[model samples]
Structure formats: C-alpha cells, structure tokens
Target chain A: MRNWCLGVLAAFAMLVGTIMPAAAQLHVDVTQGNVQPLPIAIPDFVAATAGDETPAVNIAAVVRADLGRSGLFRPLSRKSFIQKITNINVPPQFSNWQVIKAQALVTGEAAMQPDGRLRVDFRLWDVYGGSQMLGLQYFTTPENWRRVAHMISDAIYKRITGEEGYFNTRIVFISESGPPTHRIKRLAVMDEDGANPVFLTNGSYLVLTPRFNPTAQMIAYMSYISGKPRVYLFDLETGHQQMLGNFPNMTFAPRFSPDGNKVIMSLEKHGNSEIYVMDLRTRAVTQLTDNPSINTSPCYSPDGKQITFESDRGGSQQIYVMNADGSNQHRISFFSGRAGTPVWSPRGDLIAFTKIEPGSFRIAVMHPDGSGERVITDGWQDEDPTWAPNGQVLMFTRSYPNGRADEIWSVDVTGRNEQRVNTPGPASDPAWSPLIQ
Target chain B: MMKFSNAIKFAAILSVVALAGCAEKPKAVPAAPPAPPAAAAPAQVKTSSIVPGSAEDLRVNVGDTIHFAFNSSALNSTAKATLQRQAAWLQKYPAVTVQVQGNCDPRGTREYNLALGARRASAAKEYLVSLGVSPARVDTISYGKERPICAESNASCYAKDRRDVTVVTSGGATS
Candidate 1:
C-alpha cells in the first residue's frame, strides 16, 4: 500500500511538470501574437428544406467582402472549407478552421416562401472558445436579401467589438469627374461598401458637402443650382428638394439637426461666417454663434440640446462646442496645429475632424470635451472625416501624390483598422447614413 | 539695313518731337512700360519677398516659383512645358540654378492639400531631373494654398493658383 501511494504521488508530479511548461509557453505566445484582424469564415447559406425558389446571389460573398474590407476581420476563403454548410445538423469542423487560424465562424441557412419572402437563420461561433456567440433569424422579401446580409454582418461586428457595426449604413457623397479646372460634382448615395450607388443629382453645377439626416432618407447639402450658395434639403423618397432659407449671404456646410427638424449651416454674410440654425417647418432662424472669426461646420448633438462647430475665433481654426440655444461656449481643441470640420458623432460621444501637421494630413477623433485626441490616419493627404452610424468608425477622403485618383477611406475609433473603400471614380466628402429598413 | 536703322532714328526723333510738342505723348509711351513694371514689381515683390535672398537679384527662391493643381501631385501640361523651357535655359547657362515651387487650390481639406502640394513639387523636380536638368540645381517646396494670386472663389483663380513657377537663380552672376 505504501508503494502504491508513492507511485501515485510521482505520477501527479509528472503531470504538473508536463502541463506547467506547456501552459506557460502558450501564454507567452498569445501575448506576443499580433492582436491583428480577427479571421472569420462565413459559408453560403443552405437552401431551405421546403422546395423554395429564392435566387441566391451568393450573398455570403458580399457579406464576406463587406466585413473583410472593414479591416476588422480577415475572412477565410471558402475554397479551404472541409465541410459543406448545407447540413445544419453538423456544425463546422472548427478544428479545420483552427488549423487555418480562423478565430470566428458564421453559418446561415436561407429559404424561400410561397409568398416570395426569404427567411434566413444565421449562427455565429467563436471558434477559439468553441461555442456559439450569437444566433439570429431574419425574414425579408427575396429582393432584400442583400440588406439582410449586411444586418447580419453588423450584428456579428457589434457582438465582437462592443461597438455598433456600420456595415448596414449608407454614404452620401459628391461624385466627381472631368477636368481639374472645372470638374463636375453631383450628389450621390450608395451602400457603405460603395454598392448600389445612385446619383441624386446630375453633375450640372457645383455641389459641396451633402450631409444626411439621422433617418438617412433626407439630405442637407450646399448647392449652387440656385446661382447662390444656399442650403438645400432633399428627400430621397419623393425626389423633392427645397431651399432652407433665403439668407442674403452664401450658406456653406449645411447639416441636419439631430431631430431632423432644422438645418444647421454657416452663413457667410459681409465677410463673416457664423453658425445658424433654421427650422425647416417655420423657417425661423436662430443664431448659435456670433463670433467675428470664421465659424462653420455646425453639427448638432444627438439630443439637439447642444452644438459643436469649427471656428477661427481662437486665432486659428479649432473646434468648439456650445449650448443649443447659443450659450456657454467652450473651446475643445488643444492640438498644436489647426483643426477644422468638427463633425459631432451620432452617438454624441466624440467628434471627428481633420488635423494638419507639418507634411501630413491626418483624420482624427476626440472626445466632446476635447480630450482623448487621437489621429487615426496619416498619409499624403486624408481629410473630410465623417462618422459611421455607430460612431465607432469614420470615413474620409484620401488623396495620393500620383494625381491619379482620390478615394474614400475608413478607420475605426480605436485606430486599429484603416482601409480604402473602392469607388468607380475619384470620390470625396463621404457622409455616412443610418441603416435604412 | 540702312533703311531699318534710319527708320528707327526717324521714329525716335519723331517720338521726341511729339513728346516735346505734347508732353502727354512721351508720357503715354513710357507710361505703358512703367505702369506694368510698377504693378508687376509690387506683385512680384510680395510673392518673391517671401522667398529668401534679395529680390533685386532676380533669383526667385523655390518658395515663390512652383504651383500645383487642386488635389494633384503631378505637374500639369503647362507646368511641364514651362519646365522644359526652363531646363534648356539652365543648360545654356550651365551655372544657373532654379527652384520649383508647388501650390494647390483651397477646395480640399488642408492637410491633404499640403502633402499633395509637396508631392506635386517633388514630381516636378523629378521630371526636370529626367529631362537632363541637374537635380542639384532644382529644389522643391510646397505652399499648399497659403498664398493665392486671386483669392476669390472661382475656377480662374484656382487655375492660376495651381501652378509650379520656376525661379531661375543666378550662380552668383549678375546679368
């Protein structure tokens, strides 16, 4: 009996020694590994068992590209899959994906109904944890499958990052082409990944910043169509537009109030630019700022009780925030160089802007109180920072030195992911829209 | 040859006679050149004064010479053509130095324009170098819409502002 006890003790000691070194090595490797983009695998949805007639555009492909372009996820190619996704009973061989270093997996099944409706059920799995993270089911018209895919991507993103996903959003910008001297610009809107881009206006006259309403169906932009730089409100549904007000001076940089009832813009009258808010229904104008210096780019807080704008009032252009009724203004920018185009996030947590350092132009974000200033992107030239619906990401314009083309770029608030959004022609002034139904 | 020179002498005498007969006559002839020279002087002085060294030396600095298009980092057709002419002139002098200054229009967000302007100036310098112009003779810098000939918001102003002006520098030699 004493020999048996001694042998058991020796075996336990051997087990501890063997396990300790391996665990320690694993800990060290994890810490040293690049906390880079998480790799995910999304397989094509299996057709419903009930003889359905939904046309599959291979929507999985689109979702994969959208998430992959976000720079937050590195999607695995479908060719490397060991098992088919059509069989719902059998889960993905997570071990096979683990071999390929995929950290997460997404699988879905789609079916068509007699009423021409499509039902999709998706499961998100964290391969590393070897468990399901989220399981979502959605129903929509057969033609609306793409939107469903985007929403799913958004859901997965929000679950993993703790911030809302911007994949389901849209971007309204100015589509530009022609010569450098007299280039033509038109108001345009498209899916966040540059899909289904629809031109809201022809490239007839000069059109500046086209910002979206919170609902994402209306737009407030500065257009020279009326032969004067005035703020114009456009409805995507009716294709109807109306001038906000008849201010004698040019109105540049028009934005919608958080409630979408008023238009906030800069009125350049008698060589002075000041911030003003105009009610769309009553046309009653209220001045938010009375500074002599150039004050423009007014954005409203999510609650509509406060305003943030860019002003040269502090000698050089810097960001400042004021109460909704124009009281108790405070300067927020503390950077060494100039800051302009202060856009308040929809979430009302921070503001995005452009900062000019010696040789580089960077897209940056900062807290509402002007603290936690961080520059997310820096290169030859990146500017016109606009926020995604979630306020977790920003899309801006990036111009390279070759003079070949200008492209749109997006970066996350954490500054980890930076990517170039593909567009057909040179694009700029990207304004992100809220998710449309 | 005699007729040409005689015509010049006769024209000179007639102009003098006309000036003496009516003082406004010679005043108009000299006024044409003088008015342009004075106006050009102030405009050139303001632009060139920003450059280093004496403005009288006629050796415009890199800060005052080059320009670029809006959101562009490459020299335009006119800029390239002018630079080619400048390269040949530099080769003729052998000791002459030049500076290429880059600029951009004010339509873009600022920081990008600055880098874009720098890229334009560098591209001009590279092109000049490829054209047998000595790289050492050509220096480049970007103003990035800081200065404008026409400040009004229009395409004409933007076009003129987007340029690369070559300032021919003398190698310590006076013309």
Candidate 2:
C-alpha cells in the first residue's frame, strides 16, 4: 500500500525559500477560553490547463471544508470575493479583501505538468500585515488531490495557530449496524474528515477497539472469532490479519507502544485479567501486571517511561499509573465517578478517559498526576476517547440516550467546539492515526 | 430404576430377535418383516418424551441461566439453587461438556465489563466443580456487554442482561 501511494508524492521537493522574516500579525489564539472564528477568504484555485479545472475547484473546496470544520476559521463565500485570482504569483489586492472583513487569504493554482504529474502551489497571506506567511509547491498524481488539499490545509492551519495540524490523519473505527442485540461490527478506516471510507473486515465476526500503531500501517483490535475473544493484528499494507498469540485464555484491550515495537494488552486466566506486553519482532511476551483484579486499557506515555491503565484493585474501577516495568503502581484518579479506558495523550500532558457517572458516561481528561480533571463532553454515553496526533483534539464514541444510534464525535482539548463526525453507519471505538507520511 | 428397566427390556428384545435369526437357515431365510411401525412409534415417543441431557431439557426442565446483581459476581441463593440443578444434570451425564458464558448489562465500560463477565463465568464454573462436576468438563467465555439478552434501558431488562448461561457443547442428545 505504501508503494502504491508513493507515486502520488513522488517529489515533494521545496521550490522556494519558506523563511518569512516579517512576523505574522494575523493569528488565532486557540488557548483562549472562547475563540472567535477568524474570517478568511479562499477563492477557487486557478486552473492552468483546461483538463485541470475540476481538480483545482475540488482541491480548494476540500481545503475550505477542512479549516471551516476546525471551528477556528470562517471561510468567506466565494461570491463575496471582489477580485478573482487568475494568477497565484501576483500579490493579492489587499483593499478588496479588507472590505469584506477578511483577515487572512489563501491563493493557489493547479496545473498539469509535461511529465504527466499535477503541480499545486499555495500561498498563505496575512491580509492586515500585507505579508505572505507561507508558500509551498507539491507534485502528485491527479487522483491524489484530496491528500494535497489536506497538506495545504495543514500548512495554513500551522501558520495561523502556531501548532501542528491534525488535518492530514486517518481514523480507524468499528462500523456497527443491525439491532443493538445483534450488532454487526466491521473494522473500518477513513480520513480525519470522514471521507473515502473503506471497510477492512467483512463483519463476519465482532470487532472492537481498533488502534493504529505510530506508523498507521497496522491495526490492533479485539475480535470474537470462532467464539473466542482474542487480540489480532491487521496489516494495512498487506491486507492480512493474524492472531497476536496462542494464549490459553482471552486477550483484549490492546494498544501499541509509543515506539510501535510492542503491543500491550490484557490476558484473562481463571477469571482474572492482567496486563501483558509482547515484542512485535521476537514475539516475546512479558507480564506487566500480576494483580488478581481487572487491569486493562494500558497505554504508554509519550516518552515510554510509564504506563497508565484502568484497574478495579481499589474495589472500583479507576485510573492507575505505574512505571513501564510495572513497578511502583499507584492510583491517580480520585473523583466521584469511576474512570476507565484511560489513554495517554501524545503530548504527554494529559490523559483522556471515560468517566462513568451514575447514569451516564462522559469523556474527561486529567493530568498525569490525576489533578485538574475536566469533563469535555456532555453526551449520555461518550467513551473510547482517542487523541489526535497533535493532542489538541480528541475523538470518541457517543451513544444516544435512546440507545439506538452511536456516532463518532470530536472536541478540542479546551472542551469547546464539539461536533459530530459523519460515518456511513453507527460507529464506535475510534482511534485517530498519526499524520500520514 | 426406570432407565434400568428400559435397558433390560431392550436387551431381551434384542436376544429374541437374534435367536429367531439363528433358527432360519442363512441360504433360504427371507428378510425379516420390518418391526411394526406402531411398536417403534410408542417406544420412540416414550424416549423422546424427555431428552434427559439435551440443551432444551436443560433450559426447560432445569434452569440454564442464572442472574447476577449489578457488578457483583457472588452467587445468590436462587442462583445457587439453579447451579445445583445444573451440576446434578451434568453429573447424570458424565460425558457431557459445557461452556459457561458470562454477560453484562450496558451500564459499565466495555473493557471493565469484560473482566466482570469473566468473573461471573468462573464463579459459576467453580460452583459446579465444587458440586463434584469435573473441572475438565467445563469451559468459560465472557461476552462482556456485547451480547445483551435485553436491549432496553430499564432496570428489569438490565437485570436480565446481567446473567451467566450454561450451554452444553458436546455429548448431549442431538435433538
């Protein structure tokens, strides 16, 4: 799969110097309590050739959608543009954009190269400062325009917010259908914006909790095959799946290590589930937790020095942290509700978890030491929280109060801009992949 | 006593049929008349009246499922009584192998509920073993909250969903 997509990004060589000595005056402070969307203008990209018209228009539309959905940018209507951009090389007319309250502007062009490849160029401009913030060029196949569009979106987003963009990512989730009692769950993958979905499994068996490795080329999930629940690895490149091990009991709740060389999961024997880690290369299994209670959902910190998991050792389910070698285990969550499914953020600053209250389950986050806990969602049942690669946002599953629908939802780490992500059908247990290479 | 009597009668009928066959010369013997359809019908009905160690027998005659309290795997008196019946049934058919499936309500998280379900299944298996059922004859699996018997969000439905079910896997009546 990697080889096939390699041709799309055959040469990403930088064309011009990217340094801009002039500081950018137009920026969006995402950390503020309440953020007002920055009004920006993104007109249709110029098509250099007759055959490049559709790709140009589509690419610009996708970029607009990506930024608009982030709740940080309000893309102005194309009809509102006073000056039509016919050439990306020329400077934009600042007065025309300023009249429409546009703080920032993006201009780009798509052309078909003589070598049978498509060339795309984009430039982000600070309209108020009248200075160009970013300019880049990409060479790829025509069919790969969506990915190019995402790259452009990320470029603009990073320039304005001063944080890494999560637009260029994928989400691995479980697509669910049928009745609640007899649900059919298949492993599915799609873009971060819920586009170009493809099911990885046939729904012949129940699959749950799919997570991507750091490279996003492999997935680890729990499947009920032959009436036995076990952990399995699915290779995205080869389209092949194999059971993780020949354990004598059920193995589930699997997660890859930060380094992507080992998988940590739970193994049940004689009714007790304990945490275990297995090296992907040597297939050597090591027991991490020896407790008789339930210890599952283990996740490694960004530095891979410690692990955080949920356990019932204290008579109720709660989040616990321990060294990577399973020593010095201690509880970190002390709250009114039971917390489980704790996931360490990639930034290593917070841990996302599912907080089970009296009659509802909400998505919450807390620091490594368990202080400064805050609930970020108000769904009746929101669980299985997964962080974006940048750790600035989280995606989770929310089941309606009527118990009929389950949808994927995302929210910023600041507990704002909550929105529902579109899916083909009922979905759950979403895991966001790292930004694609 | 009833099983022994039936076995004796069946043996006598077999011996008589064998003697009759021996009396006839092998070369000139005609095919024996098919046993009266009526005679076979009554015997079949008598045996089919109660499949002693079948899944339906376990479900209808002896309880095949036991309920558990919310997040509690400790067997109550009623659950214990049902397990006692299941243990007796298993003992009567020593060749039978069974699997106990633990299920949970939708109130808990998926991973935690799975562990709790495992506890529920093993609790039932241990009880059956204590009642003299061989541990080798039993296996256990946890469905977690994935396979809910009832989908409603009411208390009674949740009570029904939190259960341990005993299913005969092998060595039972085919029907």
Candidate 3:
C-alpha cells in the first residue's frame, strides 16, 4: 500500500509539469499579426435533420461573412475547400484542411429540437496544430436563428482573438429619404451587417442621434415628436419609449453613459446651448457646462470619470475635456478651421471628431490629451463619428457639397479599409451598439 | 433653390398645424409632413406684400435677412444694416413678434453650425433689441444647416444659406 501511495504522488507531480507546458503551447498573441489577416475555414455545417439543412447552410454563410468583414480573419471560399463536412460531431479531417492551407477550421451541426427550437453545436479547430480551440452549443427559436449564428461567431472570435466580440451587435441610425433640404428622417435599427432593418418611428417626426446603451438593449435619441425636439429613451425588448427630461427648450445630441445609468445631451436654453446629464434611476438632472459659448456634443470616457465635449468659447469650436462633475475644463483640439462632435473611444485611448477645414470636412482622431491628430477620411463633409465596440473602426456621415446626407462610411483607425456601411437609404448619425449579452 | 424656401414655408405651415397653439415651435423638418407636394404660389405674387408674413412684406420693407462671414457669428456691416432696418420695422409695429432664425451654410459641423446659427440669430436679435425693439418681442432659433436656401455648395449659394432671417409670427397692431 505504501508503494502504491508513493507511485501516485510521483504521477500527480508529473501530470502538473506536463499540463503547465502544454497550456503554454498556445502562443496566441492575436495582436502580433495586426497588419495581416488570419486565414480561416468554415465548411458548411452538417444538418442532423432534413428540415434544418437550410439553416445549417445559412449559419455557415453568416459566420463566414462576419469573419470576413471584421478585417481580422480571411474566410476561405468553399470553392477552395478540400473536405466536405459530413459529421461535425467527430473531429475534423485536419490533414485535408492543411492541404487547403487553412490555419483554422470551424465545424458545426444543426438539429431541430422537439419543441420547434433549433439546437446548434459548433467547434473551432486549430487546423495546423490539430486541436480543438473552442466548442459551444446554442438552443434558440428558429425565427432567431440568425442571432444564434452571431452569438456562435462571437464565441469563436473571442477564443481566437483574445478580445471581446462585436459581431453580435446592432446599430441605430437615422434613415434619411427625400431631397437634401426636405429630408424625411426616421429612426431605424439593424444588425451590424445591415440586415433586418426595422424602422422604429414613422416619418411623423424628424429624429436625430440614436444612441445605444451599454447592454445594447435600449437606445436614447432625439426626436421632434411634438414639434419640439427633445430626447427619448427606447427599449428594444418592449418597444416602449419615454421622454427623457422636461426641458422647455430644444434638446438634441443624446448619448448614453458607459454604464447606461445616465444620458448626456445638449439643451438649447434661450439662445445658448449647453450640456446636461440625466440619471436614469434618480431622474436627476445635472448641468455639465455653463458658458456663454455653446457647449454641445458631450461624450463620456469609457471609465465614465471624464467627459469630452466641443465648445466655441475659445473663439472657434474646439474639443474640450472636463471632469464628470463639470469642473477642470480644458481644450484638447487645436486645429485650423473648426472641430466638433468629439467622441471618446471605448478603449479610452483616443477621441474621434469631425475636423472642419476650408471646403472640407474630415473624420479624424486624436489622443485624449489632444496630441497625435490624424485625419482618417477626406471628403466634403464627414461628421458625427461613432466608434465600433472594439475601437478599431469609426462610422461617420459623409456627403459632398450641397449633397444631402449621402452615405454612411466606416474607416479603420489606421485609416485603411475604408468602406460604406450598407443601409436601406441615405443614413446619418449612426451609433454602434456593444456586443449583445 | 426655389423649392427649398417653399418647403420651409410649408414646414412652417405644418409646424402650426401640428403644434396648434404652439405656433412658435421652430419649423422642424418632417413634422408630420412627409410629402410637401404643394409648393407656394409663384414667387412674383408671394414676394409683393408689405403686410407681415408676406415674402415681399418682410423682404422689400425690412430687408428680411442678413449674411455672415464663413464660420463667423459676429455681425458684419451688411448684417448690422439689415438688422437696423428690421428693428425700425419692429418699432413701428408694437405687437409684432419676430423669431430670429439663425442659419448657416452646410459647411460647418452640425452641432457647431447649430450653435453658430444661434449666435448669428442672437447677434441679430441683440442688435435689434439694442436699437429699441423689445426683447420680449423677439425669440431666436438656430436652423444650422438643416434649412438651406440654396442646395448648391458654391460660394454664392452657401452665402445665401448662411444668413439670419426674421420671420413674423403675428402681425402687430398697425399704427
């Protein structure tokens, strides 16, 4: 018995040593290949049941599209696929993926549940290493299967990138129609890929600046609902809305706090506009700026300890930062022409803004201390920039001279990979939501 | 260019209909008027009245609007002269309440232009008040780039858009 005990102790010690080095073998520093996209493969998901064949195909398609658009992963086309996935329940044929030169492989199976739900199980494989990197299952309604796909894509993204996933997210923007001067603006919501567009408001009133909460479940926007422009808070789950404050004047440019416990907005008092905040729980209103100059477009830092805004007090519209309590105000932007609509990045590293020059409006970013100014876009008008959840991309409203809000475009912080964010109509004031819970 | 100002007129009319007693509600675009099909009458006829609310009434008589330098809210000589005439007209009509609407060329940032438009309107209203028009009789609203008189993005068109226009809400009792 004593000899057996000693042998067990030796085995346990050896096991700890083996596991430590094995776990360290995954030297996945996703940030190292910042300039190069990782090569990935997603063979069509296997359908356990005959009726779920379409969903299995669709799930793979969406996953491929999501990964492709991220600017991080390159999804290999099926035309180049060497293996047809028939059994996702078993390990993938890694040698076949290796021949196709795929570094990573994704396999999944979809089956209809007994009560009309869809059960999807997927695994992420490190093809070159011949190992399973991630495995997860989702059970959801058939109608919401797309959301399930997004969630699955998000899980794989997080596991590989070692970062948060913004795939399962949405954006709320003002969908615009009609001529430039007679624009018909409506509040609209859609998935981040511009799918499932839903208009939340009829063309009854002009709406602007739709902002999403931290959880992406609620939004706060400005609407001229009663001929008086005021801010509104909307719930995605219930679709109910309530006016935010009893401002006797026009209130616009609403934004949510990092925690979604407060809303910061601009209130036009008499002839001057100032920044104010409203607490969601206490219904308490606090004035954040009190100056003769207009202090509009207020945004909070990711930590919520500081606020960045634009003020014209210094002769021209320049960016300013103030403490959450409205004290310690100082200017951050000092560029030619003017700058407005300052938004802090979620990573709290940079502040994106609209840089107005002679006959040009550019989307640019600067450090929080007002250093390292770099304009990412060049157009006649590119204004009101909002950051993606990952803080790598920015979406802004772009239009030419005399052009009606033409298009919504996004550019990476590195200023490459500029592309239009697809929308139903000409759109503006886009606010990206955080990853869905 | 012509259709836009008419749309503004229609927006004003709809603003009155939608808000009812709140006639002072600034003419917010798309305020229950998705299709502004009926443009105003021909410019010649509409631009002929000395009576308040008439295009010519405000234009031919009080010099309806004033323009500013690019990205500036400070009044220029042309703007001050226009406001002086507006003040004199307001003094003659004791009951007239004018809403000084500040506008800007679509050249600036939306929020900054809104603030600058407010500054332009406020600058004009202050000049009028200083010239003896009652402060209570004037209210200011900034349209920013939301309402542009010219749809083109040239120097002349943008100049036309960046002006403060005084619109009469109610004609005062004539002396």
Candidate 4:
C-alpha cells in the first residue's frame, strides 16, 4: 500500500526545467475580439531510442490537437511542411516554415533515461524572427506521456497567448445513458481532451453536478444513495466516499471554498432551501441564507471574500451576490429572462451562468458588477457553465430539442469557436479542474 | 321472500351502473367499487386480483399522483382531492409508509428545479397530513428534472412531468 501511494505521488509531480527565456517576437492578443488564429507548425518529436518512438509520435500529435482546439492557434498540416525535423537540439529551417506562412513552430525530442524515466525536451520557435521563443524539459514515467504532451502544449500556448494554458486539466461529469425515463447517470472523470475516462460509481443510482475542488483532488457531488439525495465528497486518490453532513434534510448543489477548506451548499428543510457552509476540518455547519426562497448553487470568488448564487427570492430565479459572512445580499441580474447556476471565474472578473430566454436556454457570462452580460452560445438548451482555469473559456451542457440526448460543449469567452467535446456516451454537468501541478 | 330477493338484485344492478359511470370519468374516483356485485359468486377472485390495503389498491383505487403548475407548488382543487383519497387509503392501511417523490419539467436550472421539486413534494405531504395521515408515515424526495415520464418538449408533456407521486415504501401488500 505504501509503495502504491508513493507511485501515485511520483506520477503527479513531474519535474520541469526552463532551458531558455521566452521572447515576445510572436504573440496573440487573446483579449481582443475578432482576432485571427495564428498559424503554427508541429512536426513529430524525434525519438532518441528505438523503444521511445511511439511515445515521441503520440506526444506531438496530442500537443498539436490541444493547441488546435483552443481556437487561438491553427496548426498547419504536416503535409504542408517543407522541412522534416531530424534534430530538436538545433533550430529549424526558418525559410522553409516562412514560405508556408507559419508564424510559430514547435519541435521536441523524447528519450529513455538510465533511471527508467522519460526525458522530453521541447522548444517553441518564431519563424519570422528566426529565434527560439521558449525552451523547456520534463522528466516523468513513460506511461504518463499524455500529461507530458499537455504540459508542452501549455508552455507553447502560454508563450504565445500570454495566458495560462488549460490543456493540463481534467473534467468531471455525469456519464448518462439509457432512456429518458430511466436514464443511468454515473460520475466519471477524464482528461480535458476526453481521454482515459474512469467511472467512479456504478449506475445503480443517480448522480449529478460533480464539482472539483480548486486546490485538491477531491470532488463534491449530489447522489441518491439508498433513496436519500444528499451531498457527498469523494477522495480522488483514496477512492473513499463520505456524506458531507448529517443534516436532517436534503443537502445539494455543493461547491468548495476557493481555498478548499469549506464546502458551501443548500440545505432543504420542510420544502424551503437555504445556503449553508461547513468547515471540512471540524464538520461544523453554519447557515448562510435563511430565506424561504431557493438559495442554492453557491460559489466563492477566487479571493474567498464574497459569494455568488442563484435565488428566486425576488419572484423569478436570478443571480445574486453577497459577502462571505452572509451580509449585504443583493440581486445582480435584472434582465428580461431568468438566470441561474452562477459560477465565479478563477480570475474573479466574471460569473458564468445559464440564461432562460423565451424559447431556449443559453450559456452567458457577466462581470461581477452585473455589467457586460453576453450570451456566448445559442443552443436550444445550454446550461451549467463551468470556467476554464484561466477564465478564457466556458464548458456547458447542451440538450437537444428532441429531449433524447445531452452533450457537453465549450466556447471561447469572446463567443467564438463553439465545439462539442467528445465523450463515450451522453454526458452532462461538466466541472473543469484547475491545471494539474 | 321473493320481494327481498328482487330488492337485492335491484341494488346489484344499480351498483354496476355506478361503476360503469366511474369508468368513463376523466379522473380516478376513490369511492368507486372495485368490481360489480352482480357477480357475487366470484368475489373471492376479484379480491385475489387486487388486494385491499395494498400498493396496487392505492394506485388504482385511490389516485397516487398529482400535478402542479409550471413553477408553482401550491396545490389546486384537483390535487387536493387526490391527496384526500391518499390520506384515506393510508389511514385504512395503518401499517403502510409512503414516500412522496416530486418531479419537474426540464425547463429550469437543475439546482432551482430541485428546490422547486422539494416544495411540490412537501405540498402533497402537508395536505395528506392535514387530512389526518400521520407525519411519521410519510417521507419526501425531489427528483427535479432527472426523471421525466414524458420525453417530448411540448406543454402537455411538460405538465405530465411536473408531478408528485406517492409510492409505498414499507409494510404494504403487493399484488
């Protein structure tokens, strides 16, 4: 057991080294609207040994897919490449890449070390400026090649977009199947690109709204265990599950504190739902909202100073904000339609939610002060907006008008490149994790 | 003696007519007889099929489900009448305990719909208790929009989805 735990820890802690300083010769301003995707070229990573060929080629393909999906980088096909990269230690042929209108290029090499670990080195280059923009190396077990690929993608994305990359992340969601009347929903986690999916529970009972803690590998979700619906916590490493609180009534819509020390959720008693907070260490609970109206879906700001939730206290469901101590509560949404499921961005600048229009529901985002509300997607039924760690993108669940299927979709904060994420089956209630360390 | 036998036959014919009338009614009438008394010799057969004080009796004889408006949990006259029958059925079967499940249409956010479903279930439970059912014998759960009986997105289907159903959990006979 001890050896197993140590192995898990080692897999999580990949050693990273910066070999060269990044230059700003080639940059993409992601904050601006209507920006063009920068053309990039990524050839296969050269393998130093015969046995390392598979990992080298697979890593490069994953990195290319990651950057291409971000919508800020358009990866040029290998068929269009003019020069074949044989050595990553040396700079690429800039004139060959320049003829293809490639603004940036990425090259890497993978080798098996004497200690039975994989050593991967990558460098991002500026084609026009003819210089190395960034260079980095990582050491990890050979089996964790996908994570290494994601980390390399993050480095290239950060060097170009001037923002943190979300490639090194995981998404936890409810994998749904069966028919509409008797659907089976199980809690499942996967890579951000929908790889290595593992089901945490069997589909005996229903589960919904699995949320990841910002600072830990723990998840808080609602489940109908033994016919009682309540909030429960699951440890990702140990696979141990426990009910969050022993409240006399139903507890659900749970979210973690920004620091991951407390859990805030709704407690229903005698048909009235109110917000409550519990310290995980002490298991002590405190009431946050005492209104008869629904005060659920509570989320804390990145600073842990304030909270945003959805409530019907003012007749229709709308988004509201309050202090951390439950004082000075006020509604922030005054639009014509109803709004709910408010999640504060990690950057603490915007809150993403679902807007109920006349005939449809759309995923939308607004500033903390209730200004600059923008509906990003126009699906027939789109809800449950979760933020990317950098707050530059949002993922949500979209249901078809036929009411037979539900799928997860992602869109940019600037309302561009709406695409459906691949899952094994019908899925919903997606929660994106922070960047893996 | 002949007049007494004729009176018995007349009463049996009247009850058969009443049962036929109830079958045509839109809602399930709690007071309707389970079978016609004209077939008195086969009374044991009818009782064996649908045992009194059973879960099937509560579902078929007395109404087991009631619906609410789009976003409101306040019970209407139709819903109240159904709960009254449910209370009578529970009182007759004192050993039975039930769980009221609240459901909603897929028109609202999940968390809010869950809270709304809880309200709808509580509304039914409260009415049953007010009509003399013991509070200890009734429990409540909210399914929100997770379980919808109707899959279409039309108003009629939505109305069917927004409902509360009482299910016998323990100590009830099964048929």
Write down the lDDT of every candidate, Cα atoms only.
Answer: 0.69, 0.89, 0.80, 0.88
DockQ of 3: 0.37
TM-score of chain B of each: 0.61, 0.72, 0.68, 0.73
Which of the predicted structures, 2 or 3, would earn the higher lDDT when compared with the native? Answer: 2
When 2 and 3 are scored with DockQ, the better candidate is 2
TM-score of chain A of 3: 0.90
Give per-model CA RMSD: 19.7, 8.5, 12.3, 8.2
Off by over 4 Å in 4: A1-23, B1-48
Segments in model 3 whose C-alpha atoms lie over 4 Å from true places: A1-34, B1-56, B171-175
Quick one: ranking by DockQ, best first?
A: 4, 2, 3, 1
User: Clash number for every model?
Assistant: 7, 0, 0, 0
Can you give the lDDT of residue A207 in candidate 3? 78
Two-way DockQ contest, 2 vs 4, winner: 4
Residue pairs with backbone overlap in model 4: none
Model 2 docking grade: acceptable
Question: What residue pairs clash in candidate 3, if any at all?
Answer: none
Q: Can you tell me the CAPRI class of model 4?
A: medium
Q: In model 4, what is the error at residue B154, expressed in angstroms?
A: 1.0
* Model 3 agreement with the true structure over B1-175: per-residue lDDT tens digits: 3455567678878887888875565765766747877688665544312345343566666688888988778888888888887887777667778888888988877777777787788888888989999888888877777778788879999888889988877764221
Tens digit of per-residue lDDT, candidate 2, span A11-37? 373544443444588888876523789
